[model samples]
Target chain A: MGITSGRGRLRTVSATAAVLALSGTGLVAYGLSKQDTATPPSPGRSTAAAESPSGAASSPPPARKGAAYAVPQGDVLDRSQPTRVRIPSLKVDTDVIDLGLQPNRRMEVPQNGKQAGWFTGSPTPGQLGPSIVAAHVTWQSKRGVFFELGAMKPGQRIEVDRQDGTTAAFQVDQVGQYPKASFPTEKVYGTVDRAELRLITCGGVYDGDSGHHLDNIVVFAHLVPSTAPHAHHTG
Target chain B: MRTTTKLALAAPAACAMIFAGASGAHADDGTYTMKLTDTMGNNSGSHSTATVHVMGDQLKVHITGSGFTPNSPHAQHFHGSFSENKNFTCPTSAADTNGDGQVSTEEGLPMYGDIMISLTTKGDTSPKSGLAVDRMPVADAQGNLSYDRTITLPAGAGAKLKNLHIVQHGLDANGNDKYDLDALGESTFAKSLGVSGIPQEATNPATCGTVSGASVGAEPTGGVDTGDGTTQGVEDVGILGLGALTLAGAGGAWAYRRRLGRQS
Candidate 1:
């Protein structure tokens, strides 16, 4: 009776092993098939970044000549709509557009991944609160403006050109990645005493079933008072 | 109880005065916003945005939130000590002095101060109604709550409302989806206030935010869906599948070898 039971156990183990082998082979084939179609540009290899006129990745672009105004002494700037955003290290330069909350109260993303949108609800780029700028990591198959957002490190420079023709320069302070389910809304959007900026984009494992990234990459930055001095275009 | 009665009686007179002075514009009459956030160490994923329209003594508060204890009454209040000149802000996990994982109302008082106004759905928006659970706004089936109410601020309440923090109370400590005393035991705040049989989950500060003067716009909840899975790393998936296939093949071969050996 003991021998018969041992043989039965062995048969069960063999059957389970065979099943795992079959599924594993199937999964490998599926992964290979996926590799053939998935050709989206990887992070830091954006064509837009390469084509930008300002090829230098270390220094900020020269300030556009306009009506020169005395740079404000404080970090905070008067409320002005942001027109463009440039990240020197990542070679990201994109036109800024306005974004509002969706009907569900979630932040609305840009129509495509190419442009970055400034949250209308937040304080303007150099204003005395957190200014939210968001873009997609990838739209459908194209790279987004913030595709390399997660790769950003502290001390990297981000410049936002305001509608008033003054540029708001910000120094990256910290970068964080959080699960979408537990996104720290307050830390990201809460009222801060100083002029700050938050850049957001999708990250983490992409769930094929949900067709969305599972995490969000947030970059925290503060206005660099020394670099904030720029001429406001009165025209 | 005395203060509740006094405020209830004084409410009508205040309304009459507001209506009489309706034509005159008050300089402080503007929109103020508060971005509510989690107060306790537990990442409850609860957050809310409140838009307060201050028109003279009348405050029309519209609060919308998601990820709270579903279908449970959330006791919210404007917490601050205006006369004492205390520093009012949201409490962090460090506020949990008792070493328990939760930050109780009493523990958070130092950071958020006392309740100045109870954000009840029906009546009595005073500190006396601080634990008026039945009167508070109840989250829906989806753990979302939207509250819109116009409350008459007490005589000196307007001046004190500046920079005050809004505290939204209630949490599901045991993941039971309902407020009960089983999880974290009885409410210390409620017991101190001479109320009993109330669960700590019903009174713990779940989300808190400082009120700031700003234009009214919806604050976003949760992380935004920023990717379309187009740029997912396929190489990683391929590598993972290859490793799994290798392991499975090795296991199957071993199992077959053992079975053949036993048969022989």
Candidate 2:
């Protein structure tokens, strides 16, 4: 009888010890998670983790931890221009380039390697003002970013990251397809507090003779948080 | 076999409850398949799939189609689904929540946007064109698109496409259409985009679990992308599950017996 009782006590102790170890391990794991989230990050991180209460955000763009916005002072120089965008919902991943007016006042294609340019005049994405990035529907023998712009819709995500480690996450508000002759550059690229981002591509009347789309597809998105600027870099 | 049985049994109740439920027949994801037809020409142009991805009340759409006339411009639209006894395309979600049911509009109720998808002509031509999504009005049961944008077609389109269906819609598979947040403030990806926030009726067919077979010749990259563009990495997932149901969890006692001495 004593032996049996002793065995039963051992089983109970084992179970208790297991529970204690698991709980301790769980606490440590949770602590690590907290540490990992101590500092907010750029939107491009694309991580899946538990959210911390109050969503500790970093600088300029005021989206939660994952998508931090930017504040551009002057023409902040960097190695690479933040061109090209990706939107999962739109299933678009394309390069961006500024489309200076052609002789006919149409957008131009980038001459170099997969480069998408931002309109120098506009506020870059992740910063104040509207960020305008344009790319060719087809350049040379190939197509460029925003090539499939017309296919995008609202509620999709558009991400533009700069070399300075700041990224702007643009949540599409509208996608408009208009004639290239009436590109509506002014309305599409208007300045606003919302950290708006617009993706422009050619569509509309496809002139088989000219071999280019006649109209433009414009996607509009606002900053995830336009009212609140983040505290900037965390850690 | 199991799913077939479940589907068959649920079909009747689901059909009955659909009308009894939401005033409007809406999909949680609001994704759809669009087939463009020129009633005037008596021709069917093309059919494509679109998912109006919603993020935090924001709606966006993603579209994919094969056999498209590259470089052609075609108008796009969202039309009302067919009413009962109306001769219309099959698989209209608004009228039939279950594939087995149908209802008519003359009964004083019209399903909104029974037909979804605006026409887009495909062909190569200089000078692009397309329409703003919001500008396009929601469709009523008459199969009419917003603004009667239906009168004409864009120039230069010729092709045949098949298998038009909304690939993936809704939030976290079986979860809510909005982002799922615990008291801890953790946000589910589904929540960041409002697709997860939609009501129960808007979900896509049960078979679409984020990973369905794609057509041949696709790059087969074998990695699922994380939405952010700057990240050049891909996560390898032989099984791309947005989230799948785990039916075995309810059997706690049996699970414990197999754990051999493992304690939670």
Candidate 3:
């Protein structure tokens, strides 16, 4: 699917939802209809819904910040879809699942505890913005896929194997844990000029009553320069 | 045996028992062990145990667990005594009233008493005790978490720990991440959050067990004990020797600089 065409469809979908006074549920229902077949709407075309800062991170602005490291110069991946992730340091070898937005506008967590999930609403793992992947810290008293995510030190590498015959490599830069109450929405979902990878999971104090983690552990990494050549940038 | 002879034997035994009780539920210098087992209806295939050492008002707790969610944090707490007409024991499959295939934390509450102390992560203590389920430190990469902490529990709470249940909560598969009635189907999460009046399947108690006195001088499995004083001394000496080496190297360098200046 063409990125330009996908953006056009998203604009149309958003307009229709607004005119119909769709609830969050209706909006998600519409979102899913358009999500699978098209690439995520690009940051270049500013949608009014995305411009709003009030909602669950509304929309991310265009990539205004320069990359901290040198990005691949040639064709980036065409959002070809990542199928699995392997982190040798973490001894993590798991399948990557697809996720979409919930009625709350937050990305749906991977339903399965064992699998890592990619946000279908964001760019694919090798895309130009922060491609989000998340899993539970623990599931049903069992540890989820990204359980040891916080222990990831800088310089460690994460590999995402895509449907295309290529693998996207990301080198860790920072791994920080923040309370869920003060989650850095802008920093995580904001637009960046290069392909970035974010692995997120619950951490901090576990509230037994609520059965949820109070904090979120985030691992930030950028695409390795060499892996960029293998990416087919449809954008 | 003669009555007088039997009384002589019984009196000393009774006196000794009284003296032990007067000392405290647990000796200040003694250690207690808590063996954890999977709770009723929740099968996670994890084994865990905790050892508590009471030193004055401070309680040192050492917890070791394996077969848990790899690198994840499991919310834990010491529930109130089972002596208050409550079972205070981990629930069983029969406790699955609604037939949800699993016994939730709320469903098992009648068996385990009120939460006495919440073993939370860094920075938070009582009052916000139960608030820690989500913010605690996580397990390591191997689905194992070994934690040790020294904290003061509520007054009299530590004394009753031997009769209390240590409960660990379960996870939400939907990833709504919060205890919501919509995703969890009107469970304890709703009651804790006050969204629902009645608790549905709130918190899921994955594993649970109780604390009991470990024999004095018995080989302690896990606790603040160093196993042997000699081993600890050796470690201290090693650290001190490293420090001494660094100081000697600096002194040697300084002496060489002075000699070089004199020759020049």
The lDDT leader among the candidates is: 1
Which residues of candidate 1, in runs, are more than 4 Å off?
Answer: A1-235, B1-24, B216-264
lDDT of candidate 3 over B1-264, digit per residue (tens)? 010111122121110011101212232233556767664525455567777765546778888887665555677777765236354566554465664546677677777776767777665655346635556546566767677888876565554555577777644334433334454465555366664543232256656776532422122111110001111111122112112222123333343344346546
Task: Report the CA-based lDDT of candidate 3 relative to the real structure.
Answer: 0.54
Write down the TM-score of every candidate. Answer: 0.43, 0.28, 0.35
Measured by C-alpha RMSD in angstroms, how accurate is candidate 3? 26.7
**Cα lDDT tens digits for candidate 3, A1-235:** 1324567598876676566546443433443343322123222211222243555665443311110111223234555678999988889999987665444344456555677877655557776557778765554434566666777878888999999878889888888665545566767765454577888776543322233334566788888854344334555
lDDT against true structure, model 1: 0.68
Residue-level lDDT tens digits of model 2 in A190-222: 324334666654433223233333345567777
Alpha carbon deviation, residue B46, candidate 3 (Å): 2.1
Better of 2 and 3 by TM-score: 3
Model 3 ranges with Cα > 4 A deviation: A1-235, B1-29, B82-87, B171-187, B195-202, B217-264
Number of clashing residue pairs in every model?
0, 68, 29
- Predicted structure 3, TM vs. truth: 0.35
TM-score of model 2 vs. true structure: 0.28
Docking class of 1: incorrect
Model 3 DockQ class: incorrect
Ranking by TM-score: 1, 3, 2
Candidates' DockQ values?
0.10, 0.01, 0.01
